[model samples]
Target chain A: DTAVSQTPKYLVTQMGNDKSIKCEQNLGHDTMYWYKQDSKKFLKIMFSYNNKELIINETVPNRFSPKSPDKAHLNLHINSLELGDSAVYFCASSQDRGRMKQYFGPGTRLTVT
Target chain B: AQTVTQSQPEMSVQEAETVTLSCTYDTSENNYYLFWYKQPPSRQMILVIRQEAYKQQNATENRFSVNFQKAAKSFSLKISDSQLGDTAMYFCAFMKREQGAQKLVFGQGTRLTINP
Candidate 1:
């Protein structure tokens, strides 16, 4: 069983188009996060959502929004995607906010032309 | 802000040999966690090993072990009898112990190559 799974393993889209990435965790986690790895392989947190609130990094642009339909799912939607948006996005989940061990899903490689 | 640094941008090891990857972090918080994650060509982020801040003893999992120096704020990973499948991008990460501090501060990553 896949503990964490993400859809659209690879995505290609135009610069101005909007795109979305879907993530689901069957591990019954209470916290989910989104991280981006640039071409340099520098990974940084974009957003984190728990059962109650969504915590976002100020560095992330407003075009990106994270929606957690439930504790097990966290979807990211990017508006007016730019060339800079071309990177690998990873979804991760932890048993809870207190649990430090996180399980990551196979990343989604998004390429914006 | 907490930051994880992997000074070595790349490393190589021969099959059946051992190699060490160094990592250092800067943080003001005393309670936190350190982790080593491996991402293979398939691009799946796999947790290789983990170390708790308060634990003075290093953590080891079979062939993977960590040298965690809490005072020095250094955590290094040692791989024994490296295999070709060990070739991947290894990232060091830090997480605060506080509840909901789930965001991981990751290093740029060090590309490890296991030669046959």
Candidate 2:
């Protein structure tokens, strides 16, 4: 069984279009995170949710919003996507808040044209 | 802010050989954790090993082991009897043991190619 999973492994959208990526974790972890890997392969944390509550919000644009319906699911919605949004999005989950190892899902490759 | 650096961007070694990937970080906090993650062509992040700052002994997982030097703020990963399946982009990461939502600070990454 896959501990972490993301839908639409590959997404190709046009500029100014809105898109949403869904992530679900079956590990029963309390914390979930969204990370963006740019073309240079630089990974940065965008948002984090612990027990369905927002815990960390990085210096991301307002166009991006993360919603957690429950402890097992965290979804990312991008509004008015731009060319710069082209990158790989990874969903991760951990058992606790700190010092715990994070399990990552197969990343979703997003390409905005 | 904590930063992790992997100076060697890429490395190659023949099968049955051994290789070491170096990583260093800068942080004021004494309590923290370090990790090594591997991403192959499939683009799946897989945890290779982990080390705790409080633990003096290095961490080992089968063929993968970490040499953790807290004093120098360095953590290096060594792969023994390297195999082609081990070829991947290896990343060194850090996490502080604090009271908030701890996030991982990853290094630039090292692409290791295990030749047959």
Candidate 3:
């Protein structure tokens, strides 16, 4: 069983379009995070949710928003997608905030044309 | 803002040989955690090893080990008898001990290629 799972491992869309990535964790973790890895392979944290509450918000654009329906799921919605937004997005979860190890999901390769 | 730095962009080693990946971090927080993560071609991040700042003893897991120099703030991963499966992008991360908001600050990552 996958501890953390993300849908649509690959996504291709035109610029200015909107898209969303869904993530779920079966490990019963209280903290979940979203990270973006660019073409250069630079992985950076974009957002984090703890117990269904938004906690860490990196210097990402306002067009990107993270919604947590419950503690087990966190979804990312990107509006007005840009060419620069084409990158691999990864979803991760940790048992408790910061002190515990994080489990990551297979990344979603998003391509914006 | 804490930062992790992996100076080597890429590294290579022959199978059954040994290789060391260097990492350094900058953080004012005295209490923190360091980690080494491996990302294979599948793009799945795997935890290779972890070290706590408070513990002076190095952490070792089978073929994987770490050299943690707290005074120098340098944490490096040493892979003995590297295997082809060890070939991947390795990242060093730092986590603060604070509760409720622990985010990992990652390095640029080192691409390790093991030649069989």
Q: Give the alpha carbon lDDT tens digit for every residue of A5-110 in model 1.
A: 9998999999999999999999888888999999998988898887836865547999999988999899999999999999999999886545479888899999
Which whole-number lDDT from 0 to 100 does residue B41 have in model 2? Answer: 94
lDDT scores for all predictions? 0.89, 0.93, 0.93
For residue A17, give model 2's deviation from the true position in Å. 0.3
- In candidate 2, which residue ranges exceed 4 Å CA deviation? A97-99, B97-100
Interface RMSD of each: 1.5, 1.5, 1.3
* CAPRI quality level assigned to candidate 3 from its DockQ score: medium
The pairs that clash in candidate 1 are: none
Model 1 regions lying over 4 Å from their true place: A97-99
lDDT of 3 by residue, A5-112 (tens): 999899999999999999999988888999999998999999899899988888899999999999999999999999999999999998774446989999999999
Chain B, per-candidate TM-score:
0.96, 0.96, 0.97
The Cα RMSD of model 3 versus the native structure comes to: 1.2
Off by over 4 Å in 3: A97-99, B97-99
Which candidate leads in DockQ?
A: 1
Residues A24-74 of candidate 2 have per-residue lDDT tens digits of: 999889889999999988888899998899888889999999999999999
lDDT of model 1, residue A105: 88
